[model samples]
Target: MRDGELLAFAEEERFVREKTAVNRYPAHAVKFCLEYGGIDITEVTSIAFGWNAQKYAFVSGGSQMEQFYDSLSKIYSKDVKTLASEKEILLRFQPERIESTLFQALSEVGIRVSKKSPTIQYFSHHHCHAASAFFCSGFASSSILTIDGSGEETCLALWEGRGSQIQITERVELPNSLGWLYSCFTEYLGFRPYRDEGKVMALAAYGRPDTNLERVFDKVTGLVESFPFYRVDPNYIFYGRHSYGRRFTDKLVTELGAPREPCFEVDQVSADIAYQLQKRLEDAVLSFLRHTLAKRPKNNLCLAGGVALNCKLNRVLATEQKEGLFEGFFIQPLSSDAGTALGAALLENYRIGLGRHVPLKHLYWGPNFSNDEISGVLRKSGVKYNRVSSVATEAAQLLSEGSVVAWFQGRAEAGPRALGNRSILANPTSSRHAEAVNLKLKRREPWRPFGSSMLLDAADDILIRSEAAPFMIQSFLVKDSFRKQIPAVVHIDGSTRPQTVTRENELLHEILEKFRDLTGMPLVLNTSFNGLNEPLVNTPDEAIETYLGSDLDALIIGEFVIKRNGTSPSDLDS
Candidate 1:
């Protein structure tokens, strides 16, 4: 963003169709951003790399072996032999090889530059996370917190943001990470760690937190006040290890019993463990925040990193504002590693003195298709399609008529949540609608609840409070009177994650308005536009393919509409 104006921003996974595109340079994303901004690569003033590869170089060079071994000793309480083996494995991280691979990727995309070509800068991973949150938070001065899986050497950091500058007040270096702890439980519950932590959070709502289990978690991974900041007990939580392999040691397994197998039924035992893990995480985070708030006395707090994606924890922080902890809070929409690209750019902008702190209004920063593009794809596929004058009203009508509609409009969204632009829409008024979507469309777990895209004006009427949740990042309690009215969106705990729609995306706002006019309800069931285990549709071709393969009744892309069977798009024009 230059002077508070967004040129372009997008995630690499959108174009590549990968889930998380980790370690992959975003060549396609960068090309699209430059084209969208009407600028060439040569026109760019500087490039800021998000991760400090040099830190890895030092680690791999064995310069920090003693420090690393000392931290591990404090956590593992292991003998010299065991620490030596761990150090040997750590030395295998070839930073030079990683750098070569990144440069080769850039070269393949024609982004070669000499050392004197431009002002290339490197940023630590957590610094970018902090800048991503605090800079876009629109707070003149605030306390910042970033917690995620290991980033270079640090896994957590606390900062003070004033104006366009931020100072790192404290940091919890790796070998101890709250994110790793949560991910350990995520793996134990038979879900993919890092990617499926949100699922764990959702499942936690169903189980009761066992005090004995909670005590066990505290003993293994509790936060300890370490003067400037808190640190996770490293003895139980393993960091600097690959996420694919075993996450917990024998000690954790002895305490928690056997780990759940993937695709197995989630019994009461697994659910209770998930609940206890989530509770301990929440308690530890709240303690750290309370300590920070007491010392800083800042009414505004900003959070980022992978851990910030935990909506349950975010709900506590946002709702507890009434308790005087904070008056304003903002979490980055893309709070994972995918957002580090934007964070790097934002940090460089701040350093160049061109930064203007402005609250981000939307996430529609990816590529969009024109009517001609949509029509071309439809015609090539030999599908019946027509250009409708009122796409919003037509889609709203289909949704109101108990038909699932695949909505593809404007540019794609950046993060995991699909905010109306690329979404599957249905009526939220019936439990059957959600069940059908889960069984026929998504083909996923029945226990998972769908989200909603709600009209901003009716948020207070339907939800417990009217919060600006444009990103669908936080869940709120559904009002008792409206829970039955929007059963598909209401979870077992009566909470719904909703994306509050305003005039920001005019088409989506109009659709919500028409839906409300038709059914007297202000929300539509919204979920990512993809089948089970698939990434969100990016191009019009992908959208059409998904629509044809799924049980969707109709698809609305741009101004063009396509329906299954013999129903022409013009049939809904009336």
Candidate 2:
């Protein structure tokens, strides 16, 4: 965004259909953003890549074969040894080879390159994370915190932002990372480390944090009193590794019991392990924040990184009681590596004096489909659809009647969340709807809870809130009276992650209003529009294919509504 206006923003995953685009260059995403802004590559002024590869250039480039063998030995099994070795080789040579590889990739994507290519710049990974948070926090000055798995040589950073400029105050180097700590636990719990940390958070709510587990966590992450940082005990978990294999050592397994197998039932031990890890993480972050804010006082706080995606921990930072600490908090909606792209662009814009410090309002920056495009796809697929005059009303009626609706409209969301754009909507008032959607439609785990899309005005009434949460990045306690009223959206702990819709989301707000008028409820059960293990639908065809394959009662795309042969408007009330 330039001058506080969103010209264009998108995720590479939306174009590639991959959950994460870590190794792939965002060629399609770049093209779409340029086209959306009505500009050409030559017209672009500067390009800032998210990672600073030069930081790793000092690593000794010994025999590539020996380094490869060492990488294989680090893995748990020989089945994936080759893949791990290849990845290690790539990582080892990436610093020197990245520039030429990037140039070639860009050239293949039709971007012009030469000795000087639009003043290409590189941003340190954590710098982009900090920029994405502080620049868009809407505060004239804020205390910025970015924490993630090892980025270059750093894992965490603290900065102070004042009048469009940020000054780094502290940095915690690699091998002492909170993100890696959590990710290690995630792997031990039989979940994908980076992708399924939220599952661990949810599971933690179901168990009690054991004293022994807490003691182990405290020892693993030894927080320093003199310094605002913690040291990760490498004895328990691997500190430096590129593979997804087991990072937890035999000592960790002895301390926390055997690792949970994937798809196994969530036992008490696994839940307790998750609970202890979460508690320890919260303690570490709170301590760090207190120390940082004391040295450099700031009322507003901005957070960005993969760790910031932990809504449970975010809740503690936002609501925790601490003297002379932050009173206001803003977390980047896309607080993951995917968001580094946006952060890089914003940092470059600020450096070039083409950016304005403004708080971000919404995240509907991806590609949008027109009515014509929707019609063409429907026709090509030979599917029957009606061009409804009011898609909102039709969708609202369906929700009021207890039918699940795949609601696809406007631009796709840029983050891992669906928000209102690409979502599966169901009646939040039905107690059984959560199970029905999980089993019949989504085929997801029964323990996984659903989120909600609620009117902004109704948020306070339903949730215990101290701030506005436009993104579903924080969980709030649902009011006692409304727990049974919105059973499908409430978790076992009687809390909910809600996307509070306002005028900025005009269409979604209108649909919520219609739903409220019909059912006297102000929210709908909302979840990402995808089946189990599938990335969210990106294109119109993917949306249609998912809709037809699932047991969804109806599909709403743009102004069109497609329903199964026997499904009718009357089916909504039944």
lDDT of 2 by residue, 1-574 (tens): 5453567778777777777765777777887888888876777667787887554444577444345345534743333444464357457545447667766777777876666556657788888898888888888888888999867667889888888788888998645678888988899989998888888898888779577777888778767776655567765666333233556666677766777865445677888888888887888888887777776545688899999999889878767633447766889988998888788888887787777765689888888989889889989998877777788888998888888899999888878888899999999997788877876578866666899999989887888753578889988889898998998998888888889999898888998999999989989999999877777788899999988888788899988888875434533321
Residue ranges of candidate 2 with Cα displaced over 4 Å? 1-5, 58-96, 107-116, 239-244, 263-265, 321-324, 566-574
CA displacement after TM-score superposition, residue 154 of candidate 2 (Å) = 1.3
Error of 1 at 508 (Å): 0.7
Task: Give a tens-digit lDDT track for model 1, residues 1-574.
Answer: 5454677888777778877776577877777887898876667777777776554455433545445656556655564445555565455444556456655666677777555444556788899998888878888888888989878678888888988788898787766678888888788788988788988888887779677887787677665675434456654545333223356555666677766765334567777787887877787788777776687665678899999998888888887776778878889987998777778888888778777775788888888999888888888999887677798988988889898899999988889999999999999999999987876679876667789999898898988866779999899999899998889999888899999999998999999999999999889999999877777899999999888888888899988888775565455431
Alpha-carbon RMSD of each model: 3.1, 4.4
Local accuracy by lDDT, each model:
0.79, 0.79
How many backbone clashes does every candidate have?
A: 0, 1
Relative to the true structure, candidate 1 has a C-alpha RMSD (angstroms) of 3.1
Q: Which pairs of residues clash in candidate 1, taking residues 3 or more apart in a chain or in different chains?
A: none
